[model samples]
Target: MKAIKVAILDLYDGHPNQGMRGFKEILDRYKAKHNLNLVYQVFDVRGKAEVPDLNFDAYISSGGPGSPVDSEGSVWEQRYWELIDKITACNQQADSVKKHVFFVCHSFQLMCRRLQLGEISLRHSPSFGVLPVHQTALGRQEVIFEGLHDPFYAVDSRSWQVTHPDEDNLKKYGAVLLAIEKERPYVDYPRAMMAIRFNDYFFGTQFHPEANPVGMKAHLINEEKKQQVISEHGERKYDEMIERLEDPGMIRLTQSTMIPNFLDQAILSMQEA
Candidate 1:
């Protein structure tokens, strides 16, 4: 049996987080269910400047805590970019089995900046809740988002957003803006890009697709986090999010779909090749 190698780039920078736990749960489930020879290794990209070599079938870069804008020219950022460059080069080859990548949250923000796909800037206020993201036309046809509701809910906690996409670069890279935050009819503000297909082998989401409702609810119920949500997003919003956590049609549906679907597609393609 051929081994399926996966590289997990940890960008959390030592902050305690549920994202890494979420990733582990999903990956473990998939590996067992498929009964495949799949192995994954973690590289602490931000904390230790550690990066994986171009010897893996797929890579998943995790979300982190910091400004994606301020990390430019840093050692870790440079090394990360170098890995991406190598992946891009390898994928461009006709004979090579292409490498797959999925960027989440903060990593998604950095990808937007790196690809010059959008303006990465601070939000008017922090967005911290399980919110609906409406899919674009291309997103509807996207394999990873297949069978997902047009307006699916996912956990979105970020101090920054990607807005005002550059049309030329998007076309140049053959990248499709997959999804966006729910439109505010009353506000004259640009909707943040919630997802983007960077290329055939590369995809990303601004929300945490690995965030299962049970885990999300657990995090929310933490006293400090509970107060933070109530203070920033409002008490009613916090209560509403709590209520929605158990809804089968909300974040649960999203968590079960996106990341798992991406893995299915990648694994199948690589195995077939």
Candidate 2:
């Protein structure tokens, strides 16, 4: 077996987060369980402006706190965009072994903007919960979502969203909008894009599929986070989210399905190449 190299881009800076833990746990578990010949490393993108070279076969960019838009033109953003561009160009070569990328929330927002996939903007209200996500025609056919139901649930905690699909741009790049946020009958706004296949080698979700609900619930139940959620989303929502976090049918299903499936496919593609 050829050794497979994976680079994890940490966007959380220095702030405390469950996302980093979630990624490492999933990777560690997958590696041990499969006994695959793989090695992974992490680079602090925002705090240190550190980005990986093109040596890795795959990359997973984690979600971070704050607006993806406001950070435009920052030093870190420039370096990050260069990495995206390089990998994109690398995949364009017919004979080169492909490089796969999976973008989480904050990184997904930036990817949408960079690719002109949609309108990147703030939501009327921040979305934070174990929310249901609906699939598109394309999404239903995606291998990454296999074994997952149409209206699956995942952790969505963000103020910015990728909304209003730009059909022409998507067509121009051969990208397909995959999944979207569950409709809000009373909101009178287009559903935000929850997932997209940016290309054959690139995939992303506007929610955190790698979130460990157990860890997340522990974070939320803290006195400060509990009150904060209640203040922002209401007591009822807070309680519902807390309950759903521990449910096997909700985030646990998603947690076990999505990212693991993505890595499975990515590793297979690497070996075949």
Candidate 3:
């Protein structure tokens, strides 16, 4: 069998954080566990002028720190747009082989903007910690959600989200909303789109399904981050988050499945092609 060529586009300009490192480690484990030849490479897409050729079987984009629309006109954003365009073109040109794309957080926002499938804007209150999200009707039938819970927990820490998604646009582009935020008690938050699928070969999650829960626990409790959370959301909210993160079942169930499922689907697609 040919080795699955996977390209991980690291949008972070500097050193990858523990969460990013954890994601890579999980991918490596998946490669070994599935007994598959997986060749993984990372590219820094911060200031590049050209999009590298879309020759990989699967492409994954990492989350960054801000709104994708706000980063418009910057070199990094331009390159990202170019990369997506190339991927779309490649899929269009290919008859039997379709390159797969998996976007996380910021990249998901960027994809939504580039595709014009929704509006992206700052959230009134940032979502942080393991959020409970429920799959839509289409999501339940999607391959990625197979063997996963109906309502699953996923790590989230973002100030921007897809709001008022254009359903018509999504369908026109062969995209579908897979999951959305479950309402929280007493919290009148806007309904945020949690996952999206563009055709059979492209998918994205607004939450960090790639995030390692144990690593995320440590990340949240870091002195600097903890202090920031307390200052921003109040001590009570910070305490609540800390308590929620301690649930071993939620953490384990949330972190264990997403990447593996994505890899399984991508590998099957390659083999069938």
Candidate 4:
């Protein structure tokens, strides 16, 4: 058996914090399972102005707190968009058709905007803790959702989420909405699109399945201002938020199952494509 090379793309390269570290741990665990060669590469999309032409079997775009629509935002780096466009082109091409890309959190925001699956507006913002998503028929059948019953998962902390996943977005992007979590209209956006799959090779999730128990707590305690924001408008109260953040079972399942499940899907997509 040959090792599958994977690149975990981190937008916040130098800052070692909860989001980046959790993604690193996820890559580590997946690499342990098979002949998986994993590389953690950080990039400042603004500084670099583009995504690197790194030759690897798979690419995993890690989560970031920033929005892709911001002029000074993370994925706005020309190279990042270049890579995404290239991957999407590969998906569209008939002759050169082997590519796999996974986007987490804000990374998914970039993908959605580029693919025209959803729009990025500054209307409503989402914050941390365990969110329950109602799984679509496609999500239940997808390999990425394997062994998951409740269809809800806890993500550490994120500032943005999809406001609307209309049919127009879905058709234009060639994406199937996998799951969604309902939210109130005023503070949090309704029709929040939590998960989607363009195909077997390209997948995006609004939730951070990469986060673990330890990391989530560190995030809440560290980002106090963000905590206050969550406290003010988020559905979960402060203590309840923390309790879900540190849920042992969810953490274990995320690490041991969902993360690995994503890696496995990437590997399969690469081999099949």
Candidate 5:
């Protein structure tokens, strides 16, 4: 079989702690574990005038720091929106290869906003750290969450979230809400949407399933970031995050299955095709 080509839409431009690296590492592991042929390419979409025209079996959108709404009028944002439009258009064609898209964090918010399936709002306080998320009734039936436990812990860092998801709109689009926040720990905001499925081939997650626990520990331990977290969420929360990072089980519980499951599904699809 030919190698499965995958595209990673990297939103962060040369950040030292880029999440795409973790994603690539996870996918590479998956390929080796399954003995499947898979290839991936990264496209940095920041300040770009045009999106790349390349054919791929799957696309993964990486998370970035910043509010997606704040970037609405920017050149990079507009270009990305156009790119997503093109992807959506292609998916609508009968002859086109079914394109799979996995959106994370900022990209997840962007997709929800563009589809008009949810409301994105700024939170009174930023959410940063591992959070407990519960699978919805529909989520339990989804293949992506297979073998994963309920009330799993996943890394979360966002200033905004999908506040009031339009369930009617989601159903109209043939989408399902996969997961939701178990509790509103910060800002007393209502429970936030954790995951959603727009279709069989498109999904989004509000948390960083690609983030490695070791990498997260390194990122969180940076002196500047530690102080920043302390400033934003106080010293106690920061300390808790440090403590949580030490437990490998806690880090591996929820996030380890995400990319692997997505890739396994893609492989199965290709084999069937």
Candidate 6:
């Protein structure tokens, strides 16, 4: 059995943290379950490294805290555009081979940056919490959602989002809003779309299904609770977060349910192609 060569694009700032580790965990778990030979590598775009051999089944753009569209001289923002352009070219050229792309958080913003639809502005960002997501017709039908239950839960800790892209605009941009929020919507941002599939091979998520319970709490809650933390990070109630993380049933269900389905769909797409 050959291992799936998976390239994980890490665009985080100086220090990479647990959320990044969790994504790798997702890949590791999938490999363990499916007898997959998985080659996972993280590329820190902050330095000089020509895009390594991208001869892989999939390319994943992991979530980061920075906005790729920011004018500030962030090497990551620059690198993102470079990578997307390359990916688009690969899709067009022969012998290059078309591959699947999975974008998380900042990576989603990178897609928007390429399409010129909208950049993630901090206009009305949602505070951290467990957000309920509703699947669109496309989402329900997409391979990423195949065999998954409806109203799937994902970890959303991002501030930037895909802004308003109407149907025509979305089609023009070559993307679709596969999933939306039902309850506890991020009204200000309202999560442009939880998932989008491009050309049947490339897809993205606004939420972090790669996130484990502990990772979720740290990314979603701890970061957002800056105000609370400034006044009372330790003092304020962290019991809810603790309960959510410690709950074996909840954690197991999340891990067992969503990501496996995603991995299966991705691998199937490669086989069928």
When superposed on Cα atoms, how far off is each prediction in RMSD?
1.1, 1.1, 2.2, 3.6, 2.2, 4.0
Error of 4 at 262 (Å): 2.2
Report, for every candidate in turn, its global Cα lDDT versus the true structure. 0.91, 0.92, 0.79, 0.67, 0.81, 0.64
Write one digit per residue (lDDT tens) for candidate 4, span 26-122.
Answer: 7777677664666556555544543546466677787765566774344445667678677767667776536677788777887777666766665
Candidate 1 versus the native: TM-score? 0.97
- Candidate 1 C-alpha RMSD relative to the actual structure: 1.1
> Which stretch of 10 consecutive residues in model 6 shows the poorest summed lDDT?
229-238
Displacement of residue 63 (Cα, Å) in model 1 is 1.0
Which ranges in model 6 have alpha carbons more than 4 Å from their true place? 47-50, 71-76, 93-97, 123-126, 183-191, 214-240, 246-254, 257-259, 269-273
Task: Sort by lDDT, best first.
Answer: 2, 1, 5, 3, 4, 6
Q: Which regions of candidate 3 fall more than 4 Å away from where they truly are?
A: 47-51, 184-188
Error of 2 at 245 (Å): 1.1
Using lDDT, give the best candidate's number: 2
| Prediction 1 global C-alpha lDDT | 0.91
After superposing all C-alphas onto the true structure, candidate 6 shows an RMSD in angstroms of 4.0
Model 6: pairs clashing at backbone N, Cα or C within 3 Å: 3-37, 4-37
- The weakest ten consecutive residues by lDDT in model 1 span 264-273
Q: TM-score for every candidate vs. truth?
A: 0.97, 0.97, 0.90, 0.81, 0.91, 0.79
- lDDT for 83 in candidate 4 is 80
Candidate 6 local lDDT, 151-221, one digit each (tens): 76555666666756556657885777788755444444344666777555677777776778866566535
